[model samples]
Target: MNEPISWVVAYPEIFLLVMSAVISLVDVGVKSRLRDTTYVLSLLTLAVVAYLLGASAASGETLRSFNNMVVSDPMGQWLKCFAALAMFATLVYGRRYAGDRDMLARGGEMFSLALYALLGMFVMISGHNFLVIYLGLELLTLSSYALVALRRDDPQAIEAAMKYFVLGALASGFLLYGMSMVYGATGSLDLAEVLKAIAGGEATLKGSAQVLVLGLVFVVAGLAFKLGVVPFHMWVPDVYHGAPTAITLMIGGAPKLAAFAIVIRLLVEGLLPLAVDWQQMLAVLSVVSLLVGNLAAIAQTNLKRMLAFSTISQMGFMLLGLLAGVVAGDSGNMANAYSSSMFYVITYVLTTLGTFGVILLLSRNGFESENITDLAGLNQRSPLYAGVMAICMFSLAGVPPLVGFYAKLSVLQALLASSHPLYIGLAVFAVMMSLVGAFYYLRLVKVMYFDAPTQTADIVAGADARSVLSLNGALVLVLGIVPGGLMTLCAQAIAALLA
Candidate 1:
């Protein structure tokens, strides 16, 4: 406690940075063409990183380091821990798939890049400065662009990468411009100073207030792109459909936890004074994303594309928690509302990992299980796989006895508990949308259990994938049954943030 383990919070990031370089070097000399050494080393690095972050989270220190450019607290540390572990799960579910596709043929840049991406998420989560957060966002997005095109020979992948890069660059520019405006108005690059400046009525001079609001608009737009919300969500479905399934999971899973962290850091912690304007923006985006995403998902025959739309809707749902927090400008509901969002995001990622894990397992060298029909007769081929998929689907559908149900419930509770009629109306609308969403989820389940066999092959998978997958699916069900622990953890994390 004297030295403040997370007080020196950069330790784990420094370790991850060095280990990534070492692993890359080691992969080059292996001479075996296989990436096992690189994969194993990467996993070890992530495990250690998770341990470090967990220790820091348990320490419960709200320490600011790097000249107050970064703040390490329970929320950031726990998010980092989960991000590292999610990356661990990603690599485990992906290694064989990558190997079979010759993705690791030249080397294991994928593993190293993924680690760097996690490092970026760490920076984004803990950053207390606008520029620091932007830096982390760029690192993660750039890494993601490269990863989407890792299967260089595939035209779809190459196209996806190009689209991601161009759109990502544009979003970054919007965010940077917005930050500059915010800085000009408030005269600070640090988030805390910005908040202090705004709260003190320093920006109320006519021109300054206008500029601040304009900047908030652009910032929200940029964040919408990052969160893959409506109107700014053009990149998600294409990228999700075209990238290698493993890479898709990488995009769809851990980064979301980081995205939520940044949302909390920027909107909740940094710009709470401007809540009224930004909250309205979030509400519109959430409603449109829900409407578009679910309707589009039902039309998709391809499993990946369908899930891509699902991601859009789910993200919109998560935003409900954020927008609900500042109702009537009262900060009383802030912790509970944001904590529900935190829990929703964590559970969403958990379910996403298992969902895509099943996709990767069904895929092999000559085949990609890209279509929903590919899942037909899954129960007949492997009941274990089918059951896991079903659990994830049910969770997504908000069906009972699964994690997704509780996640939706918590968000709804946060909404309904509010005094605002608008929030209650949105809650009802969300329930109706959930009903629309259930059709697609249940359709998948029906295809798995009742549809006629399309292929006679029994499913094959490595021991590691099977074990992790079982645990992942079990958590979805068990957490649904008993979500108190995680709910408490999320509430505590948010308390640290708000404190």
Candidate 2:
């Protein structure tokens, strides 16, 4: 089996790599006063990638390459498109912040790093072999570490980077150990082969099932850390709060799409035989994350910290989809549940991007825009800002007619349809916890719209920030009003994966 020479299949990753190189060269060689060049380049790169992804989707051919180490199907294509869109939004949101802070001198580096991270994402989405998956994971993890330390002068940034690096290394170790154990047990590196082996008497190997289960536990633990699930999520709050707000926005948004894809590949494709074991583990983790994330967020005064906890809770909801997809007997429901999970991830990216956009807009030099108090009397000071923030708050609260509401509803629907009584119980608990989550989001709305302005401070929002914020904020409403298009596409992607 030789690798396929499918130019169209490789176009998206090729474009990203080329654009990243060109942008880096331009940054190093060109001495221009206009800081917007990097921003423009990033936007152009994103547009090109999105166009290529769309073309690939329209072609409707699943392309596998590198001797089947990589697989490009509808699901991968759609997720890559979403990732590109999210990256574009992050660039737009970060533009003003980067420029105003004179960070554009390094903007090319940021864009390059982001593209590299995106490369990892693409690899993760398309990977069919454990080697490919681990390679992609390392690329993403390393690039992210560099990105967190982009602001070298800030001690807080350095501290956050160090923390992220250390924890990420541990997670990688766990993932590697699991991979080794799986290889030892099954004598295969390809996901499909691993599954076939397990199904065809490989389970009879001496203690193979136990070893495989333990290996999977480690693998999930590592991935769960990336997802910010409970017990493995301690780094989230500190990193979110300490890193630059723009970086925080990036972390909170697009990465989830890639993470979700990786989970599906590893758990659904590679470890399907052990679904019963992992499903139970995920159920417990999901329940804990939901309870702890919501309850802990209530005590948080720092805006970023609160959002960090919120991210953890959101992961729990995502896990519900995974749980539903891993039922003991009914594989049909599992497929539908995976589709639901896909929908949930899409909704999450939109809602989180919009939420962080508001934070970026209000943030200024010397002020992180991180405290709930920063939003005080925002309605009195700037009704537009107040209204945008309120919409984000409502969406995050899972209020009706908004994107977040649909996301939560979809996941819960998947959970409810599961045959497991405990899964249903957990779903019910998630709904109640969501109600509690609403209180804090509402509190922010109250501060923004009802409270009095403590002091009139000059808010300096640059053009890039303003443009991205307006677009991001409007997206929440637009998606809420007419979600059918994206939802239909998501359904299609999910259907393809199961097919």
Candidate 3:
């Protein structure tokens, strides 16, 4: 018998879908230069969706609908709410930046596309089935490709879009192929069923565990690509540098939370029986990502590229938390481990918004603020923005009195709690790489505070952007000082899932 559709559980996604379509359709009637109407409508839609997500979470029960293809839970709701907030902030920060650059020329494509991408993220986070997850991923990737190519006149943007499309398609193929193998081995597309089959040792395939393990390798590689880890991270710097700053913020900020969700869904939720196997793989990837990301970042003169490498290293730290969850037959700390990663990702995204927001703030028409030298004497131009950017940089470097520091601390604590020699070694290595990474971040601070101004123009931004950026930076510091509330929320969400 088919399960009754629980419309209330998916109300936010439904609302977003309707609003996205309406905005797209309405955009046609609106003229090209007046895209602010679309932007305003999109932001309103996100506000409503966030409210709906909050309401859903307050219901306090995990709700599954459509034959368990979708789930509404505290974790998904919290992640979705934050992602929507991130997108909302991104739009506010990008509006003038995009307008000044004429990227908003095509009526409402950019605004509508962002809404669609947010919709895709909502679907990805809530999906409980393999096909549903893939569908959501495709939607998000396709929207992102269009967004990157928004400035069709710019060859760099077009090239970045092409590369993103090709690489995204390849990753999608790997993920789909791996899912097929998993389905072939487990005889199910539902995550819960796959977990049941694997844990019960009833997943009968031609080669049994070997086939599942092979599928896992492909799956992890696909995920690594999305997360922009080393060896699979060739596209990150190019894309971030090539894409407009607005689009870069769109790509870098919220999709990461969705990626974390899918990893938890596919690996932690479904294939936990093979944790022993994937743990080794993730451990290796983590160490390599940390080493390569931090080392390579030191050589980058471009701020975007440096931040991209920094993102790669940050992801490696998040993976450490994920790896700490399953330790040689002791799943007792699983909730805490995953919760730590959750906290880390949430805080990382918050910091990324402010970091990129500063970049966007410094940018004006026909002038892209991409180079490290571009920030020279920024303190002389605007002490406030320089402070904001400095806070973000320090936070990313995991400095004290900042949220990023606490995020790293929580992840390391999770790893050390595992009481495993290998994890301990990884912890030591990660700390050392962090120190190396600090050089670049501190270098930016020096350039901003110490170097002479290359351009003497005033850093102009809207009140909304300035206010939001200030709040974003302030949150990084406030959360670091008092991280207990958010961390406890994450812990409760994860613990509820385990329960």
Candidate 4:
């Protein structure tokens, strides 16, 4: 008999969908009465969804629904919870910034669209079917494109949106074509069935192997664009520089966790048999990203653009953990390797949230804080904000006693444990690139601390943003000091995924 379908497995997504629609309608009615009402409602919605995810994670049981197209598991639940929390923190940092710039003046569209994007991320995390995953990806990307152009009056924002849309559509096409090829090769869209076909051995020696490999190439290309790695990273700097600071934070922060989840789901879960092929490709990509991303970032004067390049290099470190997962086809180290990547991604996102949060906090109406020179003498203006930004920069530089250090160390450990000469060399190169990257981050710190104030205007930010920014920085430090718990959790989640 077929297994009974359970809608309860998708309760969090269902709730978010319904609440998002309700909030959209409610915004039309109550937005004029109270300017911040929709914001409060959006926060409450995220809080409830987070609670549901937490409860499910605590249950420690995987549940599937809709013919296993949707799954509820510890990995998905935890990622979803964090994604929501990141969105919450993003809104907290963005509200005042948005209000001053007239982005939040009309209604709750900004909040609702963000909620929709969160809903898309949740679906992406839980989706077990290729079609479902694609659907979720479209939802997220479309929302992102719209969010980027929210400031329609700005030519830069509109131009950025056009570039994003054109490139995004092409990437989607690449992914879809790849998916079609995979389906043709395996005669199944279901990942498990495709795996069975590949593992069964008849498919590899046949004519289908070539097609499968070709499809894999396109898929990886599409994914690399999303990850903003070098050679596929042209859009990142433009988008980051063009969009408003608030939208930039939204784009940079939580979506990365979603990207990591999809990579795990599609590559690691669905296509492990082809690791040798993709591993080589990823090795090249990682090296190029580290080299180009770090070198390019050093020349950028715009803080947003510089961070965009920084993100590309950081993704290289995350890829190192991924490539370490399969050495000589020995699957014994897969869980630890993948878990390290997960931990790296999560920590990177956490650090990114705080870093961008500080940027947003420093911004005010009519004055965009896009230039690194704008940060001159930040310490003199607001010591607390400057300190938070410093912590974020230090963490990103992999300085000792910060979460980024531990995150990078874990990935390097995974690479070293592989006992491969090539990987060992790559790790050494990564360390060197990191040292180069540190010069820029530390240079920014020097400007904030030692340089004279460029803008004598007083910096004003609310209590909520200040408090959350402090906590965000503290977590980065605390997690570095005691990373055992999060590391174990990531390991357990990856183990469950493999099982």
Please report, in order, the local distance difference test score of every candidate based on alpha carbons.
0.92, 0.83, 0.91, 0.89
Q: What is the C-alpha RMSD of each candidate to the true structure, in Å?
A: 2.0, 1.7, 1.1, 1.2
lDDT of model number 3 = 0.91
* Reference-based TM-score, model 2: 0.96
Writing each residue's lDDT as its tens digit, candidate 3 over 326-442 gives 888889889989999999999999999999999998998889999999999999999988998999999999999899998999999998999999898889989999999999999
**TM, every model:** 0.98, 0.96, 0.98, 0.98
Candidate 1: C-alpha RMSD to true structure equals 2.0
Candidate 3: stretches off by over 4 Å: 32-34, 204-207
User: Candidate 2 on 313-385: residue-level lDDT in tens?
Assistant: 9888889888887566777787668877888888888878877877777776566678999889889877777
Model 2 alpha-carbon drift over 4 Å, by segment? 3-7, 32-34, 462-464
Clashes of each: 0, 0, 0, 0
Q: Model 3 clash pairs?
A: none
Candidate 4 backbone collisions, by pair: none
Where model 1 places Cα greater than 4 Å from the true spot, the runs are 1-7
RMSD of 3: 1.1
Query: For candidate 4, what is the lDDT?
Result: 0.89
